[model samples]
Target: MTAIPSAMRVIDVPKPGGPDALTLAERPVPAFGDDDVLIRVAAAGLNRADVLQRRGAYPSPPGAPPNPGLEAAGTVAAAGRNVREFKVGDRVCALLQGGGYSEYVAVNVGQVLPIPGSLDFIEAASLPETYFTVWSNLYEFGRLQRGETLLVHGGSSGIGISAIQLAKALGSTVFTTVGTDDKASFCEQLGATRAINYKTQDFVAEIAALTANKGVNVVLDMVGGSYVARNLQVLATEGRLVMIATQGGAKGEIDVLRIMQQRLVVTGSTLRTRAVEFKREMKQRLLQHVWPLIADGTLRPVVDKVFDLADAPAAHAHMESSTHKGKIILKVGG
Candidate 1:
């Protein structure tokens, strides 16, 4: 095994502000625990959560690195004493509690997975955060099933794209809302039965018409605020509303009568704060179900753009613009 380095380059958010607040700096290599593996990062995935973290609206969980990053693909550089699933020299991608922007990061073994042979490091880097979030919310909490209809908000974003593909692969019909005509078309090509342009149409009304007023069985909503009430209006009886983000606004008004009348379930989750055991179970499920699709080209991550580690600010700027259609990545190390 190669010797661990004492210091590594990392993107630091020195203050709460815009993309330019992200600065390149050097930090000590993170230490690993008994059940952890130290990864030599090849690439890092950018997420909206990172943007929130940068702006100080969202903070890293306790014990997580102060730097902003949630997922990465890399080669295992070292393994903790109790880590049996991976070893030095193995290529992997990981769901991180934090610190993925660095050259190396120590992650719990349970959060790590082997990179598919068919995917390069950049593509593998995009998988963990979006795939895990979609799987856990759409399949588990949302209770989506074959033949059920689903509505996904922000349809061209990383999480939305994953949800669209996975729902379609599982035989659920999908409708998604995007901001532009081009993005709507992009979502349809990714298997959305219909992509509603939220800028030019009322998603609630469009969904009502498309479903003959019967409504969809599930709604994956990232935009909160007024969307909550509208989502309730568009959900079928016994439907589920899974809230992953409140990009629009955190507060939402809902009609208690509506929820009860439709037997609707409103749920949501954040992947970074989940326990290691829980992530282990999620990783197992992905390996059993989704990885094959990724390997065989039945599913592919949409990488809208990539930046060098030093240019993280530009990457974040692009993401905040809300014009990109898929995941943005940072090429960190070889």
Candidate 2:
């Protein structure tokens, strides 16, 4: 095993602003606990939450590292005394509450999974955040069943593409909304029944027409604001509307009458603050159900671009531009 270092490089936000605010600094390596494993991070996945953190909008939860990465893939440098599922030197990816930006991070064993199949560290690095979000929201909360139709907004995003492929692989018909025709084509090739160009098409009308006026069974949305009413409108009777983010804006107006009249389920959740037991259970379920698909190449992560750890600012800029089709990652180590 490589001897763990006493200190490691980490990205820090000196003050909230644009990508320029991100800078590299040295910090003591995080310590591991009885149930924790210390990862020598190879790469870390970037998410919108990082952008929020950079702008001083989203603060890391108490006890989480102040820096902004949400997921990482790496080899274990050490394991806690109580950790048994993974040992030192195991290749793994983890869902993190925060601190993925550092060269070393300590994660509870339950939040970690063995890297599936032949995926290199870069691709494996992109999995946890998007996959966990998709499974927990789309399957656990939404109860999206086989043959059910799911409409995913932000279809070109990390979360969107992950939800699109997984739902489609599991037998659900998937429709997605994207900003560009290129993104639309990419999403369609990834198994979306159709990718609506939200800029040019009224998603509500398109969904209505596509479903022959019946509406979809679920709408997995990240954009909130006015999309709330529109998403409610796009749901069939007894359908579900799962909200995972408020990228458009936190406040959204929904039609109470429409929800009541259609007997619809409107729900939203944030995973970072959820209890460890919940994440543990989710990891087990993903291992049993989704890991095989990943191992066999039926499902895979889509990495749009990679930047060296020092270029986190450029990576964040790319993400904010909203031009990428999938996950953006930071390569932290060789």
Candidate 3:
């Protein structure tokens, strides 16, 4: 058996600020509980949430490490006494509550899954955070149905790509907004029916034209601020607006009369703060419904770039630039 190390290096934000605020620090390897497993991380996904946490806008949940990471993939180095689904030497990826930016992470079995198909650790690491979010917010909580039309803001984003592919594969039409024509083209190729260039084109007008003024069934918006009012404009009567992030700004004025008349539903959630049992259920659903799609090549992770563990600052900068499409990953052990 391979000997377990007592210490590990982790990316830490001793003081939250810009990308440069992130630093490498040494810490003792996390200990596992009865239902937990110790995973030797190969790669970790870099997310907008991590960026937010780095900026001091979002903090790690209570009981979670202050380091900023939400998902990782590698081999299970040790399984606890109550963990039967995984064992030492199993290849797996996990959705974490925080602290995935390390050589090892201790996570409950409920938040973990075997790596799907022939994917490498980098690809597996890219899956958990966004997939868990989209599946939960867009499908389950949003109650988006097949045959519905979805309007996704930030089409080139990780969440956008995942939502687009999922909606398209599940028999729905997808319209998305992107900043550049290149991003628009990329999204269209990835299955978005119409990728509106928000810089040149007014999304509200474009969506109205595209849907013939009927608007869409659901709008997955990350840009809150004024976009909220505009999103409500593009939503059809009884349309649902599911917000996952507020990159634009949080406060906004909405038309309550329009909401009452149209019966629009406004809702949002933060996946990092959800219960483990809920995540476990989402994990099972991913295994049952989404894993086959990945295995069969119907749906796949779109990794934009990979940075070494020591170069996390650069990775965060790249993500902040928002020029890349799909997921950004931090290569750890591998």
Give TM per candidate: 0.99, 0.99, 0.99
What is the per-residue lDDT of model 2 for residues 8-105, given as tens digits with 9 covering 90 to 100?
99999989999999999999999899999999999999999999999999999999999989999999999999999998889999999999998999
lDDT of 3 by residue, 49-164 (tens): 99999989899999998898999999999999999998899999999999999999999899999999999999999899888998888888778889989999998998999999
Clashes of each: 0, 0, 0
- Evaluate model 1: give its lDDT: 0.94
Taken over the whole model, the C-alpha lDDT of each candidate is: 0.94, 0.94, 0.93
Candidate 2: which stretches are off by over 4 Å? none
| Tens digit of per-residue lDDT, candidate 1, span 1-334 | 7898899999999999999999999999999999999999999999999999999988999999999999999999999999888879998999998899999999999999999757999999999999899999998899889999999999999999999998999899999999999999999999999999988999989999999999999999999998999999999999999999999999999999999887889889888898999999999999998999888888888999999999999999999999998999999997
Among all windows of 10 consecutive residues in model 1, the one with the lowest summed lDDT is 261-270
Error of model 2, residue 74, in angstroms: 0.4
Q: When superposed on Cα atoms, how far off is each prediction in RMSD?
A: 0.8, 0.7, 0.8
Cα TM-score of candidate 2: 0.99
Model 3 earns a TM-score of 0.99
Superposed by TM-score, candidate 2 places the C-alpha of residue 35 at a distance from the truth, in angstroms, of 0.3
Q: How far is candidate 3 from the true structure (C-alpha RMSD, Å)?
A: 0.8
